[model samples]
Target: MIELKALNKLHISSFYKWLNDSESIRYSLSAFQKTNSPDEVDVWFQSVLEDTKGLNLGIFLRDSEQLIGFTGICKISRLNKSGEYFIFIGDKSQWNKGIGCEVTRLVLKIAFCEKGLNRLMLTVSEPNIGGLKAYQKAGFTPEGKLRQACFRDGAYHDKIIMSILKNEYLKSVKA
Candidate 1:
């Protein structure tokens, strides 16, 4: 299982190491691969900690004390009770090992059980086929695709909007 722990100054070293990895930056946002010094990362981490709309979680493996990845819900709008999810695995070797699914489940648990959030949502670039499938396994469904939502690698890619309502997620979890 995975949980969202407080990311403090100490965890910054390993976390920043992950950010610098080429593989880790590949599927993330446009600024994912941008340069950042240790000081810059310190500031960024502190800023995310202060973000009011969403919780930035440091994903950890319970048994091994491994910092396998990071995941968070961002861009929240209270009127809609909606937020976007972002996740990245630090150890590329851990890919497709079911940890990502567990992390996603934990986030939904927080949203439905604690936050009383009506809807949890995310947008995955069409190129991120694996992410789209993993999200569905974790209770999200494709609402639609935004045409040419991202321009990367010299080509335009669609952004797929996916969401799970509190009722649907709760019912699925119970079943």
Candidate 2:
């Protein structure tokens, strides 16, 4: 029902809006900072376009081709064959529909099968129950927790660190 593709300039406005959405930022590190303006979003987009070590993809509805969200494997280390995973469903209406889990699997295939990465990791704020579930469902195992790693809503919260290795991914797909 959804697919991933390269993001373009046409998605700038939506990206800007999502970054500024209070609800969307509730579990995101973006709550600690500010996106400020469309120009800032454009600058960030340009950097994503030029980053050879990263892959930023737009999440779209396969039926209508609407851009609903975005996901990425960032800071890819060639030496270690690892990267940080991140995703945002900008369209609030699409939440809690198992889309996050679907997108996570798609990115895992790209990270392990295509990119030849050995490990993909992510940190989900404790309050982000949806993200935690999605990642776990997609085969990421919790490695540890970072105590008070993120501050939001006037309180510090723990972050759950999760990861899936190349071997784990291969076994999961085969099963």
**Per-prediction TM-score:** 0.90, 0.94
* Residue-by-residue lDDT tens digits, candidate 1, 40-145: 7677777877887787888887887777777888887778887887887887878888988888888888887887789988888898889988999888999999
Candidate 2, pairs of clashing residues: none
lDDT of 1 at 165: 94
lDDT of 2 by residue, 42-107 (tens): 787777777777899999999999999888998799999999999989899889888998899999
Look at candidate 1 and tell me the lDDT of residue 133: 89
Q: Relative to the true structure, how large is the alpha-carbon lDDT of every model?
A: 0.80, 0.87
| Counted clashes in each candidate structure | 0, 0
- Model 2: worst 10 consecutive residues (lDDT sum): 28-37
Given candidate 2, what's the lDDT at residue 31? Answer: 30
- Cα displacement (angstroms), candidate 2, residue 142, comes to 0.7
Candidate 1: 10-residue stretch with minimal lDDT: 29-38
Candidates' RMSD to native: 1.8, 1.5
